[model samples]
Target: MALLPAAVPALRAENLSKRFSTTLAVDDLSLTVPTGEVFGFLGPNGAGKSTTIRLLLGLLRPTHGAAWIFDDPVADVARAHRHLAYVPADVALWPAFTGQECLDLLAGVGPGTDLAYRDELVARFGLEPGRRARTYSTGNRQKVALVAAFATRAPLLVLDEPTSGLDPLMEREFRRCIAEAAERGQTVFLSSHKLVEVEAVCSRVGILRTGRLVEVAGLEELRRLRRTEVTVDLSRPAPRLRGLADLPGVTDLRWASGLQFTLSLVGPPGPVLRALGETDVARIDVREPSLEEIFLDYYGEVSA
Candidate 1:
């Protein structure tokens, strides 16, 4: 495929920073999102993720540096935004209007006359098109907003905690929509405090703290920090197990709920697993840390 006329990032924040009074909302944050991949903007509460998104959308100006969407400045977002769509965390459609009417109104916002799959989207979201937006539940409103956003076939989708109010069934449907969008070459920038959702859908994640980007890598790479749980289920008492935790790349070593003990180890598992091989092994399950577990360590360090 030929290169695009401009080699700009699908989305970018170059040393972007923002300040509100004494608070530094975003501090020297930088990230480059390539085309055709889902990049999850991850952080705990008050990590400046939303503030950065607002800057990217030209809803708010950065105190320093610049915001770019498809090589164009934030000031030029309108000109370049025909290809962009945003589903804010709060879905605030007009209360008096129906779901179909909201879609109609958004259709006027862009070139979406030929929404061939609009009906399909309504069915998939299980939304009643005739129902008033205000009467809908939170999850229903999210679906209504999502159907409107995805139906546009925009080249870029900026979803801020898109699944926040969604039920499990709706979340499953939402994931499918995002997956299909990526398969069709749409770039997705998902901002969320929910790490589990990010771990499930994002190809890569960028973690922010105190308004600065602290880490950016594939979810698997982040999980690599606490990989290889070397557990030893002893038939008899082995008093030395707890003492060996600091041997090398070991952390969170403890006896779990029942018969199994868990230890997350780094490096070639040969040494650790080999050492465990000598013990009477009941079972061993080595895997990556959960997103919650990873964030606990990650945020603890940054916040400290």
Candidate 2:
């Protein structure tokens, strides 16, 4: 028999909140991420996602409650950071230093770094180490930061919009690296606005609205709340086909021509499937809603 891995808390927050003067950046937020999990933190502009990341990184003090990384209080930056690596949304580098020099400096200051792995990442990310920092583009700068962070061999990775400037190919590489990190027993705390990327890489996600957490669940669970789109073509014209719209979980019915129509559906297909069986169906197509669609539903509800 194989032994199962023990449950451990890689990151935890208890009623964590932050305020700057009269503005409340985070509101009574609390969350826990288990070891070896890739957790997504999702929100739109001004949603306090960045503030929460800062609080966990010990860059900002919480106005209420507390946060911890591997049992070490986040208030102690030196001790807490020893177990994690961080990559910010906006990466800035010294203009005078070459990319290689910057990497060396970062590796020297971090807890522990794998020089061989760092070299492999540099090649995989297609970074020009000899180029001066001032000569690098936004994407290249981001690559430098990614290489340095991944080389640290830390137990946890805190990434905020880590793929902001990468092109499609590089973005694919980044996702592959994240999967490899998970295999190595490293936890990833990903804060991203790219819904597709989050849906592809994260096992669980938490949604935030107006500095407050509104929902947290696995992707499959969240998908249940979203509507699906179904388009169908009938063998013959039937004016009564519109009556199918009256079925439960069906909405936004529209006709394309004499025998074709489209509608939005929610929940199980059993009800819709039975209704279609009654008609002489020629063709049918169904598509699951994207994460972006579900996120918009939450955002719209909050805005209203």
Candidate 3:
């Protein structure tokens, strides 16, 4: 009896870098997305997210390192591409072709596609497949690309700003498709700055800043790193919040009207809760930071 070979990762990059003129677009970026996982690439606009995607797809070669798809080097475009399907931020289609014709052409050029699923996606996405590509709106054009990409039989799906031109309803549909793809054991590489989009689907995320990979971790872990805002209102007498100022994970302690206290908590809340128990508390509110707030904390300021 023969032994079987081990399965390869869906995507891998080892110290990948890209330079243009004087600007370094991507610098020493390394990442590994395991097979059958939905991974998110998160960053603001102009953070080299698009450039990095181009490098991975072999549309732009890296200046210093390499990337691979399912063990196939991206430098070998034909072979690497056969294992992945891509939907770019701005999809370009042949103007002369009808929507159906464009889908047909894409299906023929890719590794393969499920015809029955393709037709079903056409209906589910509410795409007018009979219309000429030139007449479609940006959202409609996006639908065509999405329908085609989701129906492909490729092992990996690379989508950049996938919900850009979609309405809220369609965005829900897109999430459903991603869920189904993961269920079918396909890997998805989703690139977007939309915190909602990433938080909804990705189990893990990579935060990119100024051409560098800053951090990569599970969403829950990332949330833990962010400070939680807590407000407390006292009754007649105020207990000493001075001691709370010395508590671990407590910062920005502020008091207002001799009765209200506010502070930022970074770690466990048990200590603060116990401390508050000694105070004459009237009302208390604890607000978890939004995903966008956590994402922004990583950058410190908005990018240009």
Candidate 4:
């Protein structure tokens, strides 16, 4: 129902830039996450992901750019933030207090927190409300932080590597919870390196490399841009030198044995498959490249 009055973008960053004394942390990046979705923010280490988040939260000023939330300029972030909840990568809570105490403290910071929902999270996250923060494990502490954040029914949730210390079951819980939130028209900006999570939760993604955005689109669209792997099997040793590498969309070839070989395939498999048709093949296999490989095109080993 994007046509609805509330269907406009919940978060937008246009030409957002930030700088240090000798480095540009964020450089002319622009992206928009519409209502009722989870948008993934991905980038490598030292890619200015954190810096950008700080800018959006008004924790830092932009060098030359603008940010908006719910159609309001970031200069009024304090007002816009009432509709947003931020879950930082690090768990920020007092070490000598019970779980309930920390959530109560967070509740005091904003509106929408209720005792009923707060109690629900204590159980949902498997946290012992009576236990102090110092007695909790890293993952448990993370759970407390999330419980505090999600307990607020904020329309926009800005998460930075939120599941860093969660267990598999908790991560699954988080995915289900986020999906439920989206069903209710809540917007999520999930920042992380977890490809699988993004693939499962986000409706679209924006890739940041060296403080700049290079791509923004649906998950399937990004996957289409990545290379595919084609494995061919033969009964015995490989044939003499062939024109395999020169074929259209063929790259990074590897010969496992006389009977097996693998190569990267881009575009439709027709051309390469047709060319290899001349060889005697027992079995054929094809699969999409890993998300890491696809992302590598943006955040490669070297900085952009």
Q: Single out the weakest 10-residue window by summed lDDT for candidate 3.
A: 1-10
> For model 3, how does the per-residue alpha-carbon lDDT over 197-245 read when each residue is reduced to its tens digit?
8888999999887788888989896555568899888886655667789
Clashes counted in candidate 4 amount to 2
The C-alpha RMSD in Å for every predicted model, in order, reads 4.6, 4.8, 4.8, 4.7
Model 2: per-residue lDDT, tens digit, 111-148?
Answer: 78889989999999999999999999999999999999
Error of 3 at 236 (Å): 13
Q: Of 1 and 2, which scores higher on TM-score?
A: 2
The lDDT of each candidate is 0.77, 0.86, 0.87, 0.78
What's the CA error at residue 29 for candidate 3, in Å? Answer: 0.6
- The runs of at least 3 residues in candidate 3 whose Cα sits more than 4 Å from the true structure, single-residue gaps closed, are 1-6, 225-293, 299-304
How would you encode candidate 4's per-residue C-alpha lDDT over 122-144 as one tens digit per residue?
78889897888889888988888
Model 1, span 5-90: residue lDDT tens: 33557887788888898888988888899888889898777777788889888788788888777787886768767668888888
Model 2: C-alpha RMSD to truth? 4.8
Selected candidate, larger TM-score, 1 vs 3: 1
- Candidate 4 similarity to native, TM-score: 0.80
Alpha carbon lDDT at 259, candidate 2: 94
**Per-model TM-score versus the true fold:** 0.80, 0.81, 0.79, 0.80
In model 2, the Cα lDDT at residue 94 comes to 84
Candidate 4: stretches off by over 4 Å:
1-8, 225-251, 256-260, 265-293, 297-304
State the TM-score for model 3: 0.79
| TM value for model 2 | 0.81
